[model samples]
Target: MELDDVDWKLLDLLQHDGRMTFTELAKRVSLSAPATTERVRRLEQAGIVTGYAAVVDPQRLGLPIEAIVRVKVRSLDTPRFRERVVALALVRDADHVTGDDCWLLRVVCRSMVELERFVEQAQRYGDTTTSLVFSSHVRNRPLTRAVVEGTAVD
Candidate 1:
């Protein structure tokens, strides 16, 4: 489905504030509330707007230490390794990756002691290379002008 200028604006606005009301959204896009609502529904149906979620700060919630864990698993242990990773509550994100690491995990813990415990359990699955994240310089970037131009994101 081809998206128009209003559709692009709607997407951009929604990305910034998912909780914005349909009336507010319609005002920003200069459309009737019903029209904006229908457009949003269409976007959802097309899998463009997958889901709305509130972004939370893990550090503020007590999970201050963020670690990037690179895991290299044995071929025979892949299934068990995945199950173990998924079962860990501290694991915020896990990616099945190429190269030396079979999986890359983003883990957050309350302290060094907590991180050490998690790593001890994680090592059972594979050889692990872990790095502590000092800070995030760039994250959750906004949609680019390409979307407004009706071009695919690079």
Candidate 2:
């Protein structure tokens, strides 16, 4: 909700390292451990801090092939397509985007053959275009107050 400078600092610190203990977080934000815990709990209750997760490397897990698959779903197949996409294990992320593509999917596979199979399955719903991801400059950058307030500059 109404976050002060201390809250913002706590958010920044937590985003960088979610595993940081309450004592460490309190020290960084200049608050007591109990205060820091209370603030973090409030943030969670307010839905500002959604969840904590570990970021893993796809390549290290044997799913090196990454692809962006854009699909323009057929009018009648929209519901079915959405359901099917969710069940797809290879789809790491899916966005219902505007413009030419109805759905943009971030898919990862073990090899080109697996990717091709995924494309074939997607084609049943509508026209599909797939592109392999060569590199990613920004994967998951932490959000800060400046960025959220539109005051951040590159």
Candidate 3:
């Protein structure tokens, strides 16, 4: 579906706050609640809106340690190693990357001992180099209408 300015605005608002009520969204886009709801449904059907989720704090969840793990896998066992890592619950996100490493994993652990054990298990499949994350400066920035239009807006 071709997205108009209103559709883009709706998407921008939803990206910032997925739980925003249909009435609130309608007010922002100057459309009726039903119209806004239909637009959101169309966005979902078009695969423009994939999913919604709540961002949880790892520290609050008792997982205080966060680390980035770069893994170097043997070419022959890459597929098998990938399946293994994907099944691991501690791995929040994993990416297939270039360079000396084949994959990068973002993981959360409870403590240094827990991280060490996770590393040991991960090393069975590939060589891993891990670095602790101090903080995230920016995250989950919303895409504005200007961004989609290839124009500039603050």
Q: Best candidate per TM-score, number? A: 2
Model 2, 1-154: lDDT tens per residue? 7899999999999999999999999999899999999999999999999999999999999999999999999879988998887468889999988999899999999999999988988999989999999999998799999998899995
Better of 2 and 3 by lDDT: 2
Mark the 10 consecutive residues where model 2 has the least summed lDDT: 81-90
TM-score of 2: 0.96
lDDT of 1: 0.88
Top of the candidates by lDDT: 2
As a TM-score, model 1 comes out at 0.90
TM agreement with the true structure for every prediction: 0.90, 0.96, 0.90
Report lDDT per candidate.
0.88, 0.92, 0.88
- List model 3 lDDT by residue over 84-146, tens digit each: 775689999988899999889899999999899988877887899999999988767887767
* Candidate 1 structure quality by residue, lDDT tens digits, 14-85: 989999999999999999999999999999999988999989999899888999988888888888877877
lDDT for model 3, on a 0 to 1 scale?
A: 0.88
List the candidate 3 regions with Cα displacement exceeding 4 Å: 145-154
Per-residue error (Å), model 2, residue 55: 0.6
- The clash numbers for all candidates, in the given order, read 0, 0, 0
